[model samples]
Target: MSVQALVRWVAAGLAALVVSAMPMAASAQQPSKSSMALANEILDIKGSLQIFETVIPGVVEKSKATLLQMNPNLFKDVDAIGNDLRKEFAPRLAVLREEIAKIYATRFTEQEMKDTIAFYKSPLGKKILTEEPNFVDRSMAAAQDWAVKLNDEVLQRFRAELRKRGHPF
Candidate 1:
């Protein structure tokens, strides 16, 4: 796959993980400060926050592309400004981190967060963490290939039915 396609797939997978982790309902009670702290620790141990590292840069590049499309001659200026904006907006990632932690804090209790952190620090958890990317990659590829075969089967069946009906298909 192309680098861009890989990046998009990874981004989408991470996004789906985040969405799945969220609480189903809004909580009337806010998470305690200690629970939030535990949630942050869980995030750190899981390295979930690393996904946010590209947010600022991606936004900057997208905006630069939009501007460059209108004024192609301003490439130099747009590039410089994009770099500056990346640095300027970098701190906004903290806000996203906090919001995600809040979601975790709301979904899981403080004890659960502590358990999660402990698991992540354990040997089995470490092994899973090391191997999960490869597992997910192979699983997704297998699923995609299976889907393609199933689609071809369905199309062939449809063509057979159409031919039976005197249609060219």
Candidate 2:
């Protein structure tokens, strides 16, 4: 490349880097479309809900398996049992769905939803909304881990005290 073109290209690259690195507000930030924000929020919430949804099926399947395992003749056909359960409980799940929808509607205000949508439209906000579920889940898992440990410690202490008193361990 010619020296002038090389210098111009270098200058353009540096300018792009500096511009990208600057605060978004310093750059001419366009306002987000509320509909797009709402869509993304819905998607994010649905995605987060799906993340922890395995337990529902897992619990059901495990229960079914345990019932059959404990009593080999309890179910003539396990598949039939499962199908019957699905058919029976499917309607009830609508109740759960309504309950969950009501909870979300109550927990988040309409204005809060608008604000969240607006925030998620921003690059930083998008990053945060994307990362926050994982962050929250991990933090919660950490807290739960500690809580379990604390419960165990307390139970062990009580057990030891009982043993000291010549009660059953």
Candidate 3:
């Protein structure tokens, strides 16, 4: 390549790098503590988890029940379902925990998450977390019922469409 062409390419590369660095420089400015707290306030981990628990309930609890029925070695007290064996079942829950924590973490800064956790530590936050599981349990059960009906309707529509089009499977 000619020297002029090489110099132009280098300048273009330098421009791109400088543009990429702008976001990092702006983010490093560090939000104020009150801003962090506000972020914490707006970002609702408990509300999100309640949504989750409603969606999944305690897979561990259900699994332990199945385990006890199958083996009886686990779920000896029914409370052991929440015990160290959670690590044994960690693989199943790891992705869920990571994904959920990520939604909470990435939405806020470090100090913001800390402040959020601190709020959840108090009476109101603690209460929300405590009650959310049951509420979601009911909500998810209804959601499941709705999903079944939706699936049947979609299936019927697909079959009718295929028949009308005279498409052979």
Candidate 4:
């Protein structure tokens, strides 16, 4: 997959995991430090925080692509600039991680976060961690195939309706 596509897929997968793991209702009060710590631990166990690692690089790559498209002659300069920007923005990844953890902290109680961490560290959780990517990939492919078939069915129905109206073309 292209870098951009891979980045998008990772981001979607991360979002899905986070949403599924969090509680439906968020706390009105600020998250406690203990809850935040547990939330960070949950992220670490799931390796979800790693998803944000690509954000800066992806942005740099897209910017580089756009600049190159505008002035192909500056390819070398653009590459250098992109590399510099990646390093400069790398630290911002921590901010994203903190924000994600805060969301988790607010959505789940400290006890719940602790239980989640325990579950993730178990054998079943390890198995899930290993297998989820494959499952998601296959599921996405199946959905795409289904959509293609649905599109064909819809088109056929549209044609039938047009024919009934004496406007088949």
Evaluate all candidate structures by whole-model CA lDDT and list the values in order.
0.80, 0.57, 0.55, 0.80
**lDDT tens readout by residue for model 2, 1-169:** 3434333433443464345444443444333445334534554644433432333454567778998888878677775777677666656644544333333344455577776667767888878867765565566567768999999999999999999999999
Mind sharing the TM-score for model 1?
0.84
In the predicted model 3, the residue pairs found to clash are 54-136
Model 1 CA lDDT for position 49: 65
TM-score of each: 0.84, 0.48, 0.35, 0.86
State the lDDT at 70 in candidate 4: 93
* Runs in model 1 lying further than 4 Å from the true structure: 1-18, 21-25
| RMSD (Å) per prediction | 2.6, 19.0, 18.6, 2.9
Model 4, 1-169: lDDT tens digits are: 5554465568676777567545634445678889999999988888886666776797899889998999999999999988889999999988878877888887788888988998888999899988876676666768778999999999999999999999954
List where candidate 4 sits over 4 angstroms from the true fold.
1-8, 14-28
Candidate 3's C-alpha runs over 4 A off are: 1-110, 166-169
**Best-to-worst ranking by lDDT:** 1, 4, 2, 3
lDDT of 2 at 47: 46
